[model samples]
Target: MYVTTPDEMRRIDNRAIEEFGIPGAVLMENAAIRTVNVIEEKYPALFDGGRVIILAGCGNNGGDGLAIGRHLMLKGAKVQAFLFFAEEKFTGNARLNLDIYKRLGGHIELVTHEEDIKTLKGSIYQADLIVDSIFGTGITRDIDSLIYKAVDMVNKSPVPVVAVDIPSGINGKDGRIMGIAIKAQHTVSFGYPKRGHILYPGREYTGRLHVVPISLPQDSSQAVGVKTFTLDDKEMAQNLMERPRQGHKGTFGKVGVIAGSLGMAGAACLTSMAALKGGSGLVTLGCPASLVPIFQSKMTEVMCYPLEDGQKGYLTLDAITGIRDFLKDKDVLAIGPGLGSKCDGLEIIRYILREFDISIIMDADALNHISRDKRLLSDYKGSIVITPHPGEMARLTGKSIQEIVASPIETATEFARDMGIIVLLKGAVSIVAHPEGNIYLNSSGNAGMGTGGSGDVLTGLIASMVAQGYSPYDAAVYGCYIHGRAGDYAREKWGETGMIAGNLLDELPLVFKDLFSLKG
Candidate 1:
């Protein structure tokens, strides 16, 4: 699903009004009508002799609230509107709606003073539902004025609140709460879901999201630079093709996973198992010689190769030639899960960066070693994917963890664009930034996925897809979605507290089966 910024949404709204010859008043009316429809359909008994209070501002959002009040009144419900601004302050479509509501003999009260706030509070205390249209996506600053007080009042009230466009005081572009934001039960977004609705903090405030189409042309949104998108199950299915009946093991592709040391053998096992479960036909785990025995005993289906190791049992630079020979027929190489942070291991990573020609997906220790010299990414020749959590990303980019977390999309996008590679910033909203400048935010996964070995599983999944002939970008997108979906399934079965990285592997078959069945 395409996500729009406030500015981009405005451009699309404008194009619909100016270029498409649709009137702004009509769009406002449609938005209000759809919002009311949602309330009625979702809660049929809400308007059965129940009083509703509409808290409106002087902007278009307020105009939508006024229209909703009028429609509710027409449906034999008691509706009262509290305009935060002076009655005369409303203009355009908003003013027209207010006039229409007044002409219908609807009750409208102007709230401008402290006494008015008290009366508004009394009215809200008696109302069954509240419609919050105080602020929309155009909100740019923190709410410190009277509106802040009103939002606090609404949040404190027990009545269910339905927000118009976006919850009041949320920065729609980035999902940050502007000092204070309304805790809304439902948000009626016009045309498409805003970035705030899917992003954190703002998502927490928005209880349930309902996107109501106000007739904005999709092509207009695309034309106006709406590049960010969230994936759904259907699109994910379309991205993956059905398996061929005549396909052999080599037809799927061979994955060379260089991971694990002496004590971190579990990391190697998880990654190799994840690759197999991720639909790779052949998986070869190249680990230190001492660790090979453990992997051989633990993993039944995964093939193994013993590479040269240092005294500490970590893969050394000498292992690079052996790994290169091992990867001769491999379609993709997944490096760096549990590969210790030793200098020799770093040397092996550097060797792969300089000489490896196959597509590479680096995670964990590989990312740690590369962060020591990020210049390798800028000069690398082959397709590369780097999956880094916040701390690792900070080290790689030489930025503070605070800076990267504050603006993850910008950080990932800029890195991907400049480095000409794919950067997967893994966290709450896993962001995949492509070299071509398109950004995708993953919509699946839950807090349960924060367990150890999750990143290894993700790296294996993404690398498996790449080996199966997917572009680095598509592989990252699909792999992230499936990995998250598997996590979701695991969470559903075992709850968040019991979910582990291995649980993701257990659910992979069910996820792939359900998704691949869509091809029929």
Candidate 2:
């Protein structure tokens, strides 16, 4: 589903009003009606003489609350609205709704003084439900003290709240909390979901989001160029690769993985095993000469190449020729998992990037090497996808981990566009960004996938997709979804705390099976 920033949403609203000739009041009315429908459906008894308190500001969001109050009053509920601003402060559609509600004999109170706050607190304590429309997506400053106290009282109250558009005090574009925000039991988002509804603390405050249509033009979002999307199961299912009935092993794809060191054999094993599970026909692991015996014994199906490690248990400058030879017949190469951050390791990566033209996936230490000189990626001749956790991304971009986490989509997309490569920024919500500015936000996976070596499995999965004829961008997007889906399956079986990277590998087949069935 496409996720819009506040500015994008405004443009869509403007198009509906200006080009489509839909009146702003009509849109507000539609939003209020849909929100009331949701409230009635979710809280069925609210209209049966229930008491509802509305905390409304002087903006369009407050107008929505007034309209909702009018609807609830018509439904035989006792509705009272507390206006934060003076009654005369409301303008436009908000003023229209306020007048309509007042003409319908709805009770209205002003919440400007301390005595009014006490009354608001008492009403909140007694109401069955509270409608919060004090602020909307357009809020650019911190909430005032009086409003903050009122919000605090509402939060402290035991009554459930239904928010309009978005929860009050949330920075709709970036999900930042402006001073304070209301924690709602349900949020009614009109047209499309805002970024605040999906990202961080705003997501936490925005409970049980309902993206209801407010009768805007169907193509309004497209007219405004909204490109960011959250990946869903249906889309992923439709995009699943079909298995040919007469296809042979050679027809599938070949994956070449160069990973592992003396003590990090698990990384290599997991990557190669995940590739096999991800449906690579021929899987090869090119490792340090000293680690080949360990890999050969642990991974029976995977072919192993003992690169010239000089018995140091890690790749060196001498291994470049062997790597080049190993990747000559491969459709895709996955580099960097468990690879040490030695100078020789960096040299090996530099050589591979300079020489190879195949699809390459860089993770772990390879990303570390590139961070020392990001221009290395800009100069590479082949398609490259880099999977970096927050720390690795910080090194690669020279930004703080906090900054990357704060704006993951921007960070990933900016880097991808600048470096001319696909970037998969790993986190609770992984972001797959293409150089062309398209972004896919992953909605699968649990905290269980935070274990070590999980990213290696993802690297293999993505490489497998690329080998199987997916474009680099598509491969990265699909690979992230499938990887997280496998982790979700693992979480179901082992719980979040107990699941490991190997557990994710074991679940990959099941995820693919489900996807294939979905395709059929």
Candidate 3:
């Protein structure tokens, strides 16, 4: 499903009104009616002679609250509305809704002075529910003044609150919280879900979200060029590769993984094993000569090649010849899981990028080396996908981790567009950005998936998908979704605290089973 920013939403709304000739008041009425439907479905008891308090501003969002008041009144609820602005402040659709509500014998109170706060408190204390419409997606400044006091009081009250469009005081573009925001029990979004409704801190304050159609034309968003989307199960299921009734081992694909050093042999083991478990036909692990015995002891399904190393247990320039030979028949190469940060290791990475003309997945120390010399990627010979966490992204972009975390979508999209490569920015919500400006926000996974070797598993899984004929962009998108679903399965079995990276491997089969079942 498409995820829109505030600016995109406004363009869509304008196109619907000016191009399609839909009246603005009709749109406002549709929003209120759909929101009331959600309220009735979720809180049926609120209409049984219950009391509802509406906190309204002077904008269209406030008009939505006023319309909702009339609907609740007609449903036999005792409704009272508190307008933050005077009657003269309202205009356009807001003014029209106010007049209609007043004509229906609705009680309206103005909160223009400190003395009126006592009555506001009394009404809130006696009400069962509150509708928050003080601000909308257009707000960008920090919330203050009497509005701040009103929001604070509403938050303190025990009444269950439902928000209109979006929670007040949230920046709709990046999900940044203003000075304060209303904490709603449920939020009814018009048309589609906004970026704030899906991203972090803003998502927490938004509570349960419901996106109901507000009578916008079907092609409004497409006409406005919405390019961001949320990764969903149905789309992923439709894109999954089908297994033929008579397919052999060679039909799947081969994956070559060059990873591991002295103390981090487990990284190599986990990567190769995850590739095999992800349905690769042949999995090869290329490591230093000294680590072969360790990898052999840990894994039996994967074939291993011990590359010549100038240094005993680490990769060096000497391994380049053997790596070239190893990549001859491989479909995809996954590099740098446990590879160390030595100078020789950097030389080996440069040699591979300069010589190879195949798909590559770069992670861990490879990303660290590229951060030092990003020009190597600019001159590379093939498709490259980099999986970087916030810290690695900061190092690569020369920005603080806070900056990357604050605006993950923008950070990833800019890097992908500038670098001309796919970027999978791993985080609480993984964001996959294509060089062509398309962005996808992953919707699965849990905190339990935050263990050490989890990224190595993802590297292998994406490599497996790329080897099996999926495009680089689709591989990254599906790889993130599948990886998270596996982590979620592991969480169900061992809870978040006890789950480990190895548990995800055990649950990979189950994740695929569910996904493939959805195919037919």
lDDT (0 to 1) per candidate: 0.89, 0.90, 0.90
lDDT of 2 by residue, 289-407 (tens): 88888998898899998898888888878888888789899999998898887527677877878887888999998888878778889889999999999999999888999999999
Per-residue lDDT tens digits of candidate 1, residues 370-460? 8777778878889899999999999888899999998999999999998889999998989999978798888889999999999999999
Residue-level lDDT of model 3, residues 1-520, one tens digit each, is: 7889999999988888899999999899999999999999988998899999989999999999999999999998899999999999999999999999999999999998988888999999999999999899999799987788888999999999999999888878877889899999999999988988878778888999898998999987789999888866677788899977687778889999999998888888888988888888899999998888889999999999989765578887888889889989998899889987763667887888888878999999889988888888767879999999999999999999999998899999999988889999999889999989999888789899999999999999999888888987889989999999999999888999988889989998899988888878
Question: Candidate 2 has which clashing residue pairs, if any?
Answer: none
lDDT-better candidate, 1 vs 2: 2
| Per-model TM against the reference | 0.97, 0.95, 0.95
Against the true structure, whose lDDT is highest? 2
Candidate No. with top TM-score? 1
Candidate 2 residue spans exceeding 4 A from truth = none
What lDDT does model 2 reach? 0.90
Q: TM-score of model 3 relative to the true fold?
A: 0.95
lDDT of 3 at 70: 94
Full ranking by lDDT: 2, 3, 1
